[model samples]
Structures are given as C-alpha cells and as structure tokens.
Target chain A: MPSFFTGFELAARLNAETRRRVAALARPPRCVALLDAANAGMAAYARRQQAFAGEAGIVLAPEPYPANPEAVMRRLAELAGDEEVDAVVTLYPLPAGVGALEAALALGAGKDVDGLHPENAGALALGAPARPPATAKACRLIAEELAGPLKGKEIVLVGASRIVGRPLASLLLDAEATVTITHAATRDLAAHTREADIVITAAGVPGLIGAGHLRDGATVLDVSINRGPHGLVGDVDVASLEGRSVTVTHVPDGVGPVTTACLLANIAEAAAGRAL
Target chain B: MPSFFTGFELAARLNAETRRRVAALARPPRCVALLDAANAGMAAYARRQQAFAGEAGIVLAPEPYPANPEAVMRRLAELAGDEEVDAVVTLYPLPAGVGALEAALALGAGKDVDGLHPENAGALALGAPARPPATAKACRLIAEELAGPLKGKEIVLVGASRIVGRPLASLLLDAEATVTITHAATRDLAAHTREADIVITAAGVPGLIGAGHLRDGATVLDVSINRGPHGLVGDVDVASLEGRSVTVTHVPDGVGPVTTACLLANIAEAAAGRAL
Candidate 1:
C-alpha cells in the first residue's frame, strides 16, 4: 500500500499555530463570510469554516449570499471598507448568475481572505506579495513536506481551474520546478504524468488518474473532492492506485484539511496586513 | 534552414489600425510614462515609444521617477485617481530602492496599460477582463496568427519572467494548449522543446536557444531583444537557427513592436473605462 500523506496532521498543527496567532492579535480578527445556499458546493465548507473560526478565536460573521450581481458587489464593497471586517470570503456559489471575479474585485484586496481577489492572484503570479488560494498553497506545502524542494523536479499538473492547476503552477514555478499543466483539452494526459517526478490531479473527475498514471515511487497529490458512492473521493482512485509503490494523499483527509488551515493563515495575514 | 515568422508585417498592420482607433477617440488617450535616470532598461523603449505615440496620435507624458517608497506610492496613487490619465507605466531602474510592485499597485487596475498592476495580472490569470502583459499577448497573437486555435498543442515556454513567460502561460492555458514552463533551473531544456509543436524563448540570454533546440517546421517566437555588438539580437540565434526549418521571428522586429501595439490596445480600453 502507498504511504498516505494526510492533511489532518498538517491542519491540526496549523490550527494550533493559528490559535497562538489569534491570541497575539490586538483584537480578534473579524472575518465576514458570505454563506452560500445549500445547493451550492460550499455548504460543507461553510460549516467547517464556522467551527474552525471558533477554535481559532476569530470572530466569524455569516451573511446570506446576495440576491443579484449588483447586491453581490455592493455587499462586498461595503465589507471591504468596514474597519471591523479584516477579512472577507464568500462561499462557492455567488447566486446563480453572479461571477466570482466581479464579486471578488469588489472585496478589498487586504480583506480577501480566500485569495480569490485578482490582486492576490496577480501577486501569486508575479512572485511578489502573496495571497494565494488556500487549496493550491496546500498542495505545495504537502509536496515540500514529502520532497525536500521542488527545484529541478518535473511536475505534471492535471487541471487548469483558477483555484488549483493555475495557481499551483505559479507556486511550483516559483519553487524552480519545471511544470507541465494539462487540462480536459490535453490528449494522452498519462504521457505527461508518466514523465513526471510528481503528479497533482485536480480535474474533479473521480478515478481520472489510475495506477498506470504513475511510475514507481511517484508522489501524487489529489486536490479533487467528489461525492462517490463510497463517501467522498478525489480525482484519482486512491484504493486502486495505493499499492503501486506510489505515495498518495487520500480523498477525505488529503487536501481538504490543509485548505481549511491555509484559509486561517490567509485571514491571519490579512489581519496583520501583508502589503508592503 | 528553419522557416521564418516576422512581426514586422503584423506591427505595420496593427499600427495602421491604431491610427483609426486614435482618430476615433474623443481626445488623445493620455499615457503617463515614469522614467528612471539610472541604468533602467527602458531608455531605448522610451525613445521608440515617443516616435510610436506620435505616429499613433496618442499623448506620451514623461514623469521623473519618484524619490522614496512613499513618494512612489503617492505619485502612483495620485495617477490612479486622475480621470485624465488613461495609462501608467514605469522603467526598470526604479530610482534606487523603489519596488515595481508597490508602484504598480498604486497605479490601480484601470490605468495599468502595461498590465503590471496586481488586479490586471489577476484578471489575466482568472481569464477575465484580460489586460495581459504586452509581450505575452503578442506571443499568443503571433502563434494564433500563424496556426489556428492552440487547443491540444504542446508548447514549450523557455522562460518564467514576469513580463513574458508567466503571463503568456496564463493566456495559452486559456487557449487550451498543453504548456510546459521552464526556467533557469530547468535541466536539458532541449529535450522539452524537441517534443513541442511551438517554442517560445524569452530567456534574455543571447543565443540561449540554438538550431538543435527545435524540431523541423516548429513555430518559435523569440521575445528577447539583447544589445549585442551588431545593434540588437534575440534569445535564439536567428542567424544560426534560421536554416533549421523553424519559423524564427527576428529579434529587433519580432516581439518588440507588437508589445508597443498591445500597450496601446490596453490604453484604448482603459480610456473607455474597463472597470465594472
């Protein structure tokens, strides 16, 4: 069986650290969250966030998702200027017709805890002031924990979602790793992965990467969280790919926990004001 | 011998079109250029820009590089709020200690014609409201102009500079190309380029890519314009790599002219107020 890399351990350690940082703050960092409706993919995340915020000693204020695009921008713009709100993050769905880009732009770059703000995204690409997406950042942290450094490593990143593959490529490139980014358009995805020292799949399709997708001892980080018959799963078939002499991060406890931890980290940084 | 791709033709066509765009504007789109007195690399660029601005009927205003960090931010902050300014750009040698990022951040997204502003960069990454770095955009334009959609194409990008490789990757990813980004740390760069249908080199090292670097009939765009004994050169040895059946763009006329054109495109959009 493959040696499992668990975000549960990393998240626990980070939470302990977050508690210390929160206590050190002059006042509890005020975090305002826009709770997405249950139909949206963020209900589970919202539940986890509220519980986590309490443990970290930060004030988590929840609000309903705005009705229209105008309301979305208005609410975000309002929170952006409020002195009490040090951080602002919205759930996955910003109403049916709303786009996250517009809503994120309305949120002040300093208060954008989720790092969905374009300013944060630009900072990540520029290798400058960083407010990277939590999930992508967690992938790098996991890779580093397993492998010493990503320098000179050939990494195959499957998926180009702004949340994962895109930002992850920036992070890996910053680490001096040669990165190949493939998506749904890519033909023969395994051809690229077969030549990689590390393979990270965030394609969201369950069992998209099989045991044949990796070579012996390759490190695989799965960022996909899908609802499979056997509870939650990731982009790869972890059960099948487990015994191929590969290292794998499981579905339930893999990237999910670290993503939550990184969100706390961003909130802490935003409260501290990361701008130079 | 490699086939050749020339930007001179594209530059002429774009310039001819720019003349009409400039005539259509209510007033000349006001451009602010912040120049550094020291060894900033933009002295030659500013010279070309002045000539180009006149030809295109755009106003080019020069400003002294601000003194300190605070002054840099303050000046950019002032420009950010000014309704009269359509675009803002800066040269490399930013006084002594001024960081480009702080100045860029101060420029605000709407007026950052060079697309260095964090918001613009983020938008480029998120694949919305695209105001990509001029040179990067030029590469994609050249590629698409030669070959149709980049879908499923294997492209090897030979640099990771903020100006070119980084943003180009985002644009190409949006185009659905399988992109492999290599930087200074990449070992055996030739091996990667060999498998690519398209190769782009912006490494800034003169003669960094040679004849052996590409396959037959591959499309190569050279963005590096180095000042050699013979006036100007590029990252690839055009003289040497020219006969390898590779479509090589000349150094002086390849990516340089297109960059200036793209800058104008951004200014045109900014003048019209691209913000929501």
Candidate 2:
C-alpha cells in the first residue's frame, strides 16, 4: 500500500511555532481578513482561518466588504494604513468582476500575509526576499519534508495558475529543482508525470489524475480542493493509486490544513516585520 | 542541412512598426537609459540601444548613477516622476552590490521599459496587461515565428536567471506551452532537451548544448551571448548540429538584435501609455 502523507502533524507543529512567534511579539498581531462572507469558498476558508487564528494567538478581525471592487479596494487601503492592523489578507472567491491583483495592490506589500501583491510575486520570481503565497509555501514545505531537499529533483507541476502553480514553480526553481509545468493545454499529461520524482497538482479538477499519471515510488502532493458529487475531492483519484508503491497526500487532511497553518505563520511573520 | 532562423528580418519588421507607432504620436518619446557605461556588457547594450533609439524615433537620454544602491534608487525615482521621460531602463551589471530589485522598486511601473519593475513582472505572471522583459519577449516572438502557435508545444528552457530564463518560462507558460526549466542543478539536461519540440537556452556557458541535446526537426532559440575563445559564442555549438535536420538561431544575429528591437518597441508602448 502507498504511504499517505497527512497534514495533521505538520499543521500542529507549524501552528505551535506560529503561536510562539505571536506570543513573543510586544502585542497580539491584529490580522484583518477582508473577504466577502457570501462566497462559498471564502466562507469555508474564513471559518478555518478564524479557528486557526485563535489557536495562533492572533487577533482575527473579519471585515465583510461589499461586492464592488472599488469598495474592496477602499477597505483594503484603510486597513493597510490602520496602525492597529499588523497584517492583512483577502481570501479567494472575490466578487465576480474583482481581481486579486486589485486587492493586492490596495493592501500594503509588507502587510499582505497571503503574498498576493505583485511586488511579493515579483520578488519570488526574481529570487529576492519575499513571502510567497501561503498555499504555494505549504506545498513546498510538504514536498521538502517528503522528499528531503528538492535540489535536482524532477518535479512535475500540474497547473499554471498565478496563485499556486506559477509562484510554487518559482520557489521550487529557487531550491534548484528541475520543474516541468503542465496545464490543460498540455498534449499528454501522463507523458510528463510518468517521469517525475514528485508530482504536485493544483488543477482544481477532482479526479483529474490517477494511477496512469504515477510512476512507482513517486510522491504526489495534491493541492486542489473541489466540491464534487461525492463531497470534497482532490485533483488525484486516490483510490486508483491504492496499494501502489507511490506516496500521496489526500484532499482534506493534506495541503488544506498545512495551508491554513502557513497563512497563520505568515501573519506572525508580517507582524514581526512590522514590530521591527 | 538544417535551417537557420535569423533575427535580422524580424527585427527590421518590428523596428519599422515601432517607427510607425512613434511617428503617429504628437511628440517623440524620451527614454532614460541608466548605466555605468564602464561595464563591457552594459557598454555594448548601451551603444546598440542608442542606435536603435534613433531608428525608433525615441530620445535616448543616458544617465549615469553612482555605485551606491540608494543613489540608483534616487535617480530612478527622479526619472520615474520626470514628465519629460516617457520610459526608463537600467541595463544589467548594475554596480557590484546594487541589486535590480532596488532599481525596479524605485522605477515606476508604467514607465519601466525593460519590465524589470516588480509590478510589471507580477502583472506578466498574473496574466494581466503588462510588458514582459524584452529578451523574453524576443525569444517568444522568435519561437512563434518559427513554430506557429506555442499552444501545447513541449519547450525546454536551459537557464534559471531572473532576467531571462525565469521570465521567459512564465511567458511561454502564458502562451499555453508545456515548459520544462533545466538549470545548472539539473541532473541530465539532454534527457529533457531530446524530447522537446523547442529548446530555448539562456545559459551563459558557451557550447553547453549541441547536437547531442537535440531531436530531429527541433527548433532551437539560443538566447545566450558568451565571449568565448572564438569572438562570441552561444550556448549551442553550431558545428555540432551543422548537418542535422533542425532549425537554430546563431549568435551575434540570433536573439540579440531582436531583443534590442523589442526594447525599443516596449519604450514606444510605455510612452503611449503615459500619453494617455
């Protein structure tokens, strides 16, 4: 049977470290989360974030913004300038017409805990000092933990979204890993995955990858969480790889929890930067 | 015999279009070129830039800044705010300790002709409207001219530098191509290149790739210009692939002129944006 890499232990360890960092600060870091509570994805993430923020000793202030992009920008700018707020993050599933870029621009670069700001993204690509998006950071940490140092490893990344795939590829490249990024337009997905030492997927399509994409003993880090007919599902079809020699991380208890912990850690770090 | 994809024709076509664009505008765009003029690489680029700027109908104002990072930043900020300067670019090899990030940060995003500014880099990565680095743009245009429509094509990029390889990989990804980035840490470079439909190299090492790293009918876009025992050499050894049924771009006239043309084109675009 393939070994499963669960996130519970890692998340706990990270949360503990985050808690310690927050406590060391002169005052509790005030993290203002600007999100629309109406969006299903953002709502779910908010719930997890609130819970995690409490455990990490961060002052979580959830500010509900209107659907208007301008209003979102105004709120972000206000929060960015507010002396009381140490860090800020805007969750995904923003209003239909609103872009994360706009929000990232309005939120100050130093306080952008999610690292959605273009400056942060640019820094990551340029190999400068910057905090990467939490989801990408979580995947990198998980990959490093599972496969030791990523240097010289052949990693096949199945997605090309700016938030996850693009930035994560930059991080992996910084670690000196040989990275191949394949997307929906890729001619043959399996042709790329079959040769990978590790396959990281953020395609957001449940059951998109199966045993056909795996090579024996390869480690798979599934970063997608899609709502399927059978509840939540990951990009990988775990059942197909059952009893295989590969090791994999499942949907709910894998990248998700680790991502939350990483965000909290980022908030703590942002707070520390502000403290300095 | 293999075919050669020279940059002269494409460069002339692009330069003519740039000339037309600049002529249509009410005023000639003033471009500020900041460099030491002492570094050999910067000197060569500056000379070409001055000649191209004249051809493109742009006012090229070369400015020299001190070695201190702060001085570079101050000059960039002044030029960014200068109404007369429509575009700004800082050549590579900025004094030994001066990093590009600082210069990029100080240079306003809209006027960054080279697209070195973090905001522009972020915009390119996010699929937003922004100019990419001129060299990356040149490579993409050359690849597209040789191989129609990059969608679903297998491309192997042989460098990981922030200026060329990383941004070029992002540009290729945006074009919907499957990109494999192999750097100095890659175990077997040939293993990745042999299966590629197109191989774009920016690795500075001369003769790093040859016929052994290619498949029949592969299109190779050599983006490196190394000063070797022979006057100037590219990453690919042309003699090694002399009789192969492949397409290659030679040094001196391969990617160099096209890159200069692209930079002039970008200056036009930036000037046009500022005119609005």
Candidate 3:
C-alpha cells in the first residue's frame, strides 16, 4: 500500500505555495468568482476560498446564473464589466448547449484562469503558450509526482471529456508521452489498461479499474469522486490493489484539492498576466 | 491479392453521386474548396475540383494561407460570408494542423458540413443527432457494408486522430459495437487488431497491418492512403491477406470515395440547415 494525500491536503499545500508566491511578488489580493449555475456544490469552493483569503485578499463568490450559458455569459460579461476582477474561475460542469465552454473561454482570455476557453484549449492542444486547464494540470501534476518524467511513457487515459480526458491527453501528448484515450464505449477496456505503464482514470465510474484491469507495478491515478456507503470511491478500486505493485491516490486526498489549488494558481497567473 | 482502387476512380464515383443528389433536390451547384495550405498541392485540388465540376457547377479556388488556424479561420469566415457560397469543405492531412480543422468548424455551424465544429464534435461524442466526421462515417459505412450490422461485434481502429479515430469510435459506439481505438504509441497494436472482428487502420504507416494482424474471417478497412512504388498502399497489407477469412477494402476505392461522398452530404446538410 502506498501513502495517500486527500484533495484537502493537495489544496492546502497548493494554497500555501500560492500565498508564498503571491506574497513574494507583492501583488494585490486576487478575487475569484466561481459560477455555480450547473449546481456544483458550494462547500468545497467555499473551503478553497477561505484558505486563499486567510493568506491573501481573496473573494470566493459562487454566483448562480441561468442554466443557459449564453445568458450566463451575458450576465458574467456584465458582472466582469463592473468589477476590477483579477480572475474568473468557473466550477460548473460543461454546459448543455454548444459554445457554453467557448463563451466561458471568451470571457476576455486574459481574465479566464479556467483554461476552458477555446483559445487556451487550442493553445494547450498545440503546446503553445497558454494556461492549461486547472483539472488537467492537476492530473498531470499527480502523474509527474507518481511517475517522474512521462516522456515516451505509455499513458492511457480512460476518459476523454473536454475538461479532463481530451485536454489531459493533449497535455500528456505535448509532454512527449505516447497517450491513448479510452471511453465507456471502448472495447476491451481491460486490455488497454493492462498495457498502460501509467493509467489515469477520470470516467467517474467507481471501481472501473481494479487489480484485474492493470498489470503489476502500474501506477494508477484515479480521478473519479463517486460517493458510496463506505466513503468516496475513485475510478480505481484502491482496496483490491493493496498487495499489488500499485500506487493509489485516495479519492478525497488525490485530485480534488490539487485541482482547487491549481484553480487558484491559474487565477494568480491571470492576475500576473501570465501567457500560460 | 486484394484489389485496390485508384484515386481517380474513387473521385469519379464521388462526383457522380454529388451531382445526382444535387439534381434530385433541384439545388444550386455546391462548391467545395479544399484548403491545401498544409500540402500546397493545387494540381491535386484541381483534379478533385474537375471531378465535381463535370457533375455540377463547381468552382475550384486555390488560396493558400498560413497553416496557423486563425488565419485559415478568417479566410473560411470570409468565404462563408459570400452570398453565392452554400457550404464549405476542406481536406485535412496530418500536417494541416487541428487549427485548420477548428477554423473549418468555426465557419458558422450552419455552413460546417464536415461536422468538425466543436459543437458538432461534442454532439458526435455524446451520440446525438449531429453528423459524425465524414471519414469516420465512411469507415462505419464500409464496415457495415462488409459485415452487416456491427452490433455486438468487436472492432479495433488504429490511429486516433480527431478526424478519423475519435469520431469513428463514437460512431461505432452508437451502433452498439464494441470499439477500441489505438494509435502508433499503442503497445500491442497487432494483439488488439487480431482479436477484432473488424480491423480498421488509419495510421499512415504503410502496411502496418498485414495478414498477421487479422483474425480468421475478420473484415479489414484500410483508411490510409500512402503512395508508393506499387502505387497506393493502405495501412493494411492487402497482398498478404490472400487466403485468410478476410475481406479488405482497397486503398484507393474502399473508404476514400465514400468519405468524399459523406463530406458532400454533410455540405448539403449544412446548406439545408438541418441541425439548425
């Protein structure tokens, strides 16, 4: 069994680092507004905001907007117009209609830290100078920590969502790693997983990856946060891989906190006018 | 030895179908301009245009822009703004860059027949009403033609380019087929292909799939178009699959023409504003 760090721990360390970095730069406090119209829980976001506020001038406003992203974008554009906001972080899942993400990306690229903007997404995809999506950057960070230097490694991602899978794949590919993306409809999912030296599962399916699905000594990064009677379960079955040469990052301590911290880092970058 | 079709034959049939479809609908001549900036081969574009012109009032304009997609997008937007233009089409190769594809997609979803628009791409990924990419659709059509109804069948797609691989996987998933998408980086490409009831290879690697890669009675669709001394070579080594329980599509005739027709169909759909 390997040591596990919860999302809280990751977020804490990230916030600490962000504070130190922001303080060193002698910059003004950053304001981050999370549009929670998609019904993303506010508790986690609040917790992240408080952590940031303790160290720097941080405002975490989770404004609920209409489900229609077009309308939301219009309102967001208006809100952004009024405030001298440093950065806008959106926590909602991909919107229902087309261009929702595109609209978010269009929130004046300089103010967008979420990296879901098409320009940023395209930049990341092309390995150009652009801030990578926070969740994807977090996933890559986890992979880097678990497995040093991913170049030429056979990394298989089990999900291809725009936020996680596709963007992550692009990031990994840019890093010189040979990446394969699998989805729910993928045939012989186990076959692909078993061959991967590193497996990143973000398909949101609990117990999708088990010892049976992976080869011995394979590093597994589970990104799913499925709640069960026991507790939060990941895409990988951590309990079953206790004796295997597998390193499991527990759900709560794995990607969540790191992702939040990365979000803040993105905000800081946007505030600093970092190109990527 | 398995037979292969020349590019000329494929283009001829494709033009005839385009003309017939346009005539049936009593519509104006549809113009499809191939942006060959990536390859800069106007002679090839001219030949393709000639095929279409013989059937309908087609115009072939060769305007080379920087490979960077923003410039290409502006050009596409300019073309889409024309009153005489009904739809727009662009040919893509490995070097054309995703930016070009993205630009083609951004040419107003109403005029995007290739279904490469992010909105349409997302819809295809979600198994919605939007048409799949033309190449992927052609691959599916060929697979079904060779081996009726792919439901419950095992299919393996080599090469996961957004144009062919990713969308093809989505189409197969919609058909209730078990699909696996592998790339050059895949650890055991042959192992997966050998087990598949249908092996569709799109990797430009000439003869990457041969008799050894196919299981007995497996249907093979070679989507690669590699010109060589013996003429065009597909991803699959058609000559080696001679007595095996296999049915392989020729490089020139098989999926190429179907893909062209599918693109024309997508253009028609775009002009008609089917999804709008």
Better of 1 and 2 by lDDT: 2
Model 2 chain A weakest 10-residue run by lDDT: A89-98
Q: Give lDDT: candidate 1, residue A225.
A: 82
If both were scored by DockQ, which would come out higher, candidate 1 or candidate 3?
1
lDDT of 3: 0.68
- Order of models, best lDDT first: 2, 1, 3
* Candidate 2 ranges with C-alpha deviation above 4 Å: A35-44, A67-70, B39-44, B63-74
How does chain A of candidate 3 score by TM-score against the true chain A? 0.85
- Cα deviation at A27, candidate 3, in Å, is 6.5
Q: How much DockQ does model 3 earn?
A: 0.14
* Residue-wise C-alpha lDDT for candidate 3, range A1-276, written one tens digit per residue: 544545666567778777776665445545555445444455465655656555544455555545675786676676566445677665555445635555564576667676655456545543446787788899888888778888767788887666777677667755656666677666678877898888888988888898898887788888888878897788887777767777777776688768777877777766666322
> How many Å off is the CA of A58 in candidate 3?
5.3
The better-scoring model by lDDT among 1 and 3 is 1
The C-alpha stretches of model 1 lying farther than 4 A from their native spots are A36-44, A61-63, A66-78, A81-84, A274-276, B36-44, B61-85, B239-243, B274-276
Residue A5's lDDT in candidate 1: 84
| Candidate numbers sorted by DockQ from highest down | 1, 2, 3
Q: TM-score: which candidate is best?
A: 2
- Candidate 2: give the TM-score of chain A: 0.95
Name the 10 consecutive residues with the lowest summed lDDT in model 1 chain B: B267-276
DockQ for all models: 0.76, 0.74, 0.14
